[model samples]
Target: MMGWLWAVQVILFAAGTGLGMSDARRKSTEVRLPLWVRMLISLTLTAAAFALWRDDPASSSKEWIFWGMAWSFIGDLSMAGIIPWRHPMIGGMLTFAVAHVFYIAAFAAALHHEGLDLMNAGLAVVAVFYGLVLIAAWLLLIRNPDAPRLFNIGSLVYGLWIGAMASAAAAMAWSLGGALWLTAVGGLLFVVSDTIIGAAAIGGRLLRHQGYWVWLTYVAAQMCIVYAFTL
Candidate 1:
């Protein structure tokens, strides 16, 4: 039954991905899952995170992911506008940023075992790498002052944090190649997912099939991260 639980999660994620892609593929679709149902499918994130606790909740790294994923679930609802907050978008942004903080901490913890020099070198590579991405977002969102800009202020800070998270995860992969590579992959996917979201939100509209790509990358990102640690 425990193993079956993971299978069920895969099923839910696949179903949710299909529904989301279908909805986003074309506006002319005669049928669609309600927005709330689509958002609820994200509960699988929480469930998978919970399963990670089977190893050792006392471990700081595991605990961080546990809480991080919990925040991510809330973020999903907030972004979907299912939460009753007056400013659900802001709430989602804040919650997901917090989630990244926890993930950064967890990733950093894992890399601490390696020498500080190696870890720092790896992180520096990504920090510098993501600067180009940051510059691009600024260029795109500059024209639309009215639209939400994830490149601005608090969102900018959040972007950097996730960049740092990516750096840490990459450092781990470099120093200890194996399942840690999945962590690196997950981190990169996260950055990609968020970049797509920021671009669309800043433009005030999703590009053709952009929503499908967003959900697909986001789900895959979380799954990779979870599976990396669990492995």
Candidate 2:
């Protein structure tokens, strides 16, 4: 029944995403939903999921994952709705970034008192990669003055945060020698999702059939990431 619940959660999330995209296609901006309503729905679902995992206390990984999902839904809702009050739109991105950090913490907690040498080196390498990719993304986006500065900066922060999580997971795997390959893949999907969004925000008009590719890429990215966290 608990597994079924998680499956239902996935279905709801998919439906919401599809509906949101359909809305996007019809309307340039997303239709607004109240933030409190969104938060309540997310909280209720998360509480149910948490109840399912209570029996298996050893699977602490799922706890982090559960909260991550909660935060994700909130962030998604936050991004979708336009608040009447003056608020920083980037707050949603920042909140999601923090959620990714929780995922990193979960991966780290999974480590069994391992030494930090290998992990530190891995983190350093991932940091370098993150910097390089950020630079490339900005260089590409900033060429056009019309490109939203907020969008570019948000992408940079998101990329770096997810990159760090991926690196942390990789480092944990190296230290413990377990099958956490999904973490790395999840990080790659983050890149894929952001790249699609960036393309749409920048050269989408120039690119032929940008809408189809963007939709496909973003959906795939989300699906990959959802499964990655479940792993």
Candidate 3:
């Protein structure tokens, strides 16, 4: 039953991604179909993933991941909604920031259960590498006058949390001697997806089919994170 549910989730996610990409490629400003369709599909996928892992006996990390997914669902909804906030992107950024916090907590919990050595030289190297990337991202976003001041600050904070999450996942994978590749890959892809998003948002420039790439990487990243626990 669990396997079938996961299959369904994958299928739904693929369908949602297709629809979203098609919508993004449309030349018309007015959307023919509602964006909520894809958002609902994404929410359902995360819910199914959570249900599949709800009874895991291995560690409480699964619960934290579930919360992260839940927060991601809310972030998606907030991003799609037509709210009249002063800074429109703030709602989505705040929700995703909470989601990243949950993801970081989940990865930390997994690291604890595996008894990985955080002080390992490789882990230190990974930390320093991502630390530099985070610093670069901070400078890029902060210097963008096109983005609202509050949004720039929010993006910087959220970027730090996500970078930390990725660093933690990489450290765990290294400490475990390459057994947790899913977490590492997922964390890296998540960072890539958000980096693209931040760049597009701040620079006000859309690359070719940017939305398609963004959603594709983002969905795959979330799925990989969910699948990491099954290993």
CA lDDT, every model vs. true structure: 0.71, 0.57, 0.71
Give the alpha carbon lDDT tens digit for every residue of 1-231 in model 2.
555645665565556556656676687854322334334445545565356346456666656766666676666566556433233346566767877866676666666434344356766777688668766765675234665766666666666676677677666655654345656665666665555555555534334444435434533443443344344
Error of 3 at 138 (Å): 4.8
Which pairs clash inside model 3? Answer: none
Candidate 3 or 1, higher TM-score: 1
Question: Where is the poorest 10-residue window by lDDT in model 1?
Answer: 29-38
Deviation in Å, model 3, residue 75 alpha carbon: 1.2
Candidate 3 per-residue lDDT over residues 1-231, each given as its tens digit: 557656776676666566655775685432222466557656765775587566674567788888888888888777767544455567877888888788777777777887755556656787788778977966864348766787677778777777777777777677764546788788888888887787777756556666666776877788777777765
Which pairs clash inside model 2? Answer: none
Per-prediction TM-score to the true structure, in the order listed = 0.83, 0.64, 0.83
By TM-score: ranked, best first: 1, 3, 2
Q: Mark the regions of model 2 whose C-alpha exceeds 4 Å error after superposition.
A: 1-55, 58-60, 82-89, 112-118, 141-144, 147-151, 202-231
Which pairs clash in model 1?
none
- What are the per-model numbers of colliding residue pairs? 0, 0, 0
Alpha-carbon runs more than 4 Å astray in model 1: 1-5, 17-37, 113-119, 141-143, 148-151
